[model samples]
Target: MDLCLKLGLLLVIYTAVNASDISVYIPQIAQKITTNVTDRSFVLVQPNCIFTQYPTTNVWVVVALNKSFSTISDSALSTPIPYSSYRNGLYNYYHTLLVSAGKYPCLPSDSTSNKVIQIGSETCKGNQFCNGVLSNNQTYRAKFILLNSSGIFDTTKWSNEIILQQGKSFQGNTGLPSGRSGGMIVLTSILSVLMAFLLLSVIAALIFGGRDLCWKRTMLNQKHSDRNMDFMPRSTYRSRYDNMYLVS
Candidate 1:
């Protein structure tokens, strides 16, 4: 009995310890890619983090066109010059405006014109402001950055660059998977305890009930044997007395 209690206590402690080890803040980002049929093209950015509610931060979507996969330097993006205007090689790097939290379909903002450009338009005429036309069959890579309200970047929290091809749609998750919240961990622990207790109760009842049934059956068999012995002796004594009376 004492051993059973010790094991149960150990199980509960093990569960609690394991649950505590789980990380509460696991960063993640979900990206969706789409294309426009017109002359201009850009990747729409959407950002999601496991700890989104805890911080009020701005998300920046950065794109490097036709560049080999390389670490995006802070200096390259943080400069006063807008990314669309800065030319590195054959293609230019572009970044979107500061996206508010929980916003979707973050369109790229043109740095030179200081306006959001239409997705598929060719020229900056009428309602359409041409940012840059993405050539079909070209490849573009993009990433996301999390920054504080004061424009300070969190070096630890950034997404892996995802490559998208022109006229093709891509979707995927970036970064570590999200961990369970405090409430969910607590709920899981409670359920485990309840199930363990229920299992123990069932095992104990089966053992005790089996013992009681065996004892009742043994007592019933003993009573039947005693009654048979008593009846046989009475019949033998009555037969002997009748024989002696007939001989006299």
Candidate 2:
């Protein structure tokens, strides 16, 4: 009887623990990018997003359209990105959505399931050209709104908004005082000129100062030779009596 009771208690405890595990689902929405000047449509690039729960952390996986959608046609239904996190491990999934030129309103087909929403869009009001019976040529702004199911958790919950704009361009070697490759060349040339000047200065100093040193040494050697010549006895001397004095 005691063993059965213990077994029953263990079963109850396991169920309680699993019930407290947190599950989060987020829905994605996006605004189609359009411009008045050109009929090109674009979308914002996916960026890292963060989700925080007390003592629990999560990362976002972005999803978007696989192909460009037109203004006249409806967006094709695509798959949603599936991402999940239990604790330290990251479960990220990539999916795509279809967006067109006009404003798109979306809601999940299943309302009973708990989920959150994230909308992606751009900021520039670029114009799109439409060759239709009636021209709808106007600059349209992109907007994204995030929504969550009601009564999911007790923590503070609200929709988050993000706007996209024209990304900064890569200004290649332009608008600089020196050109891209020219800067290095100029620096190298300056260094070479300075080195050449230093070498020339050293050579000039050596030419003037070394001449004096060389001349003094040569004159000293010549004087020593003359003294040696004077001390030597002459081979043409007739006899010792002929020369009265000894030369040292």
Measured by TM-score, the strongest candidate is 1
TM-score per prediction, in order, is 0.34, 0.24
lDDT of 2 by residue, 80-163 (tens): 222122011231212223222121223244431222222322221331111111101222222122222321121111112222
Q: What is the lDDT of residue 193 in candidate 1?
A: 100
Q: How well is each residue in 102-221 modelled by candidate 1, as lDDT tens digits?
A: 443323443212222233233323322124444444455555555564553532323343333444321113232235455787888999999999999999999999999999999989
lDDT at 59, model 1: 52
Name the TM-score of candidate 2: 0.24
Question: Which number leads on lDDT?
Answer: 1
